[model samples]
Target: MNYQPSQNDIVNEYIENLSAEIAPLFLEIRACILEAGPEFNESIKWKNCLVYGTTKNHIQTVVGKGKISLIFHDGVAIEDAYGLLEGDGKKARTVRITSPDFNRAALQDYVRQILQRS
Candidate 1:
C-alpha cells in the first residue's frame, strides 16, 4: 500500500518550519480561528494555510513578503458589517495584515463571526 501524509500533518510541519518573524503571526491567526469554536480544522493544502470546517476549503491564509492574507472561500455568504473584508470575487474575500502590531481583538471578532456563520 502507498503511504501519504494527512493534510493536518503537512500543515503542522509547515508551521513548525516557518520563519521566526512569520511564525508568530501564523500562530496568532490560527489561535484566533480556533478560539471561535471547536468545529474548525486546518491543514497546509495548495501550499497555503488552509482551514476547514462548516465547509471544505472554508478558509485559507497566504503569507506574502510583508503581509499575511486571510481568505474566506465562501465569503459571499458571510456578513461583513464592518466592511473589513476585501476582494470582489464572486465567491471569496480576503483580509490582509501588514504588520506585527495587527489588531487582535478585531481579528478575533472577525473569526468569531465567520465561524458562527457555519
Candidate 2:
C-alpha cells in the first residue's frame, strides 16, 4: 500500500482508507479502547491505530484487509483468564477481531491492568 502519512494524519483517515468490512469493526475496537479510561490517548502511527495510557502505549491496532489486529505491548505478562488473546510472542500478544462483536470487557480489563502496571 502506498500510504504516505503526514503530521496532520488522523485516525479517521486511516479508518476511511480501509475496506468496508474492516472499517466498522476497527472503529468498534477503537471504541473499546477509549472506554477503558479517559486518560487513554489516541494517535495514528505507521498507518496503524495506537491507544496510549498515561505512561506508555497500551495497544496498537492493525487494520488489515479482512481483520483488525489488537497487539498488546506487554501481553506476555498479562493474565488471560478468558483465553481470548492470541499469539505466543515473547513480549507481545495479538487479539484478532474479525467481527464487530469482540470482547470489549476483556479489552477494557487488559487496558486497566496495563495502565495499573505502568
Candidate 3:
C-alpha cells in the first residue's frame, strides 16, 4: 500500500498563513483531527482541509471558510448518532465543528465509528 502526506502542502500553507484571528482555532482543529492516526492522510480537497483515513473509514473532515465541518461520506452509517447532520443524500452529511460549541465525546465517538467501519 501507498501513503500520502496528511496535510498535503496546501493545508500546511494555509495553517502557516492563517491570520492570527483564526490561527488558534485552526491549530486546535488540526490537533483534534490528528487524533485519527499517524498513518491517516491530510490533504486539500475542494479547497478544504481533508483528513483521509488510512483504511476504509468513511469520513473526510475539513475546516472551511467561516466554519469547520466533517464530511460523513457515508451518512447512513452515522446519521442516527449525530442527530445534527443535515442533508438528504445517500452518501454525505455536513457536520458543523466549532470547538466552543462542540461535543468532544460525541466527536470522539464519531471518529471511533469511522475507524470501526473500516
Candidate 4:
C-alpha cells in the first residue's frame, strides 16, 4: 500500500468523543489498519461508522458499548486462515475487538488481503 491518505477531521472528532473504555482499543485498531493498508482513506459513513477504503468502502469501524467491530465489506471474499472474521452476511464479515490484546497479526493479514483485492 503506497497511496497513504491523511485522517479525516470528522473521524478524528468521533474518536475524540469515544468513551475511555473503548477509545484506546479503537485507537489501537485504527493504527493497525492504517499501518497494514496505508492506501486506505479514512472517512465517516452512515453518520457514525469510520470507514476505510481506497476507491470504495472496505472496512467499517463500529464502536459498541465495550468493543469495536471491524466490518469488512468484501469479507466473504477474504481468506480467513486465522479464523478471526465473523458474520454470515452475503458480503460483509466482522472482527469484534474487546481488549487491547486483540491479534494484531491476524488483523494486519485481513487488511493486506483487502488491499490486494481493492
Predictions: Cα RMSD each: 5.8, 5.1, 5.4, 4.0
Least lDDT summed over 10 consecutive residues: which range in candidate 3? 1-10
Per-residue lDDT value at 2 in model 2? 30
Q: Write the per-residue lDDT of candidate 1 for residues 84-105, one digit (tens) a residue.
A: 7899999888889876677777
TM-score of each: 0.78, 0.80, 0.70, 0.92
Better of 1 and 2 by lDDT: 2
lDDT of 2 at 104: 86
**Quick one: ranking by lDDT, best first?**
4, 2, 1, 3
Q: Give the lowest summed-lDDT range of ten residues in model 4.
A: 1-10
Off by over 4 Å in 3: 1-10, 36-38, 55-57, 99-101
Give one digit per residue, the lDDT tens place, for model 2 in 13-104. Answer: 76557776665676677667767865776677654665554567778877677887888888888889779888877988888888787888
On lDDT, the leading prediction is 4
lDDT of each: 0.70, 0.72, 0.61, 0.87
Residue pairs with clashing backbones, model 1: none
**Candidate 4 similarity to native, TM-score:** 0.92
Which pairs of residues have clashing backbones in candidate 2? none
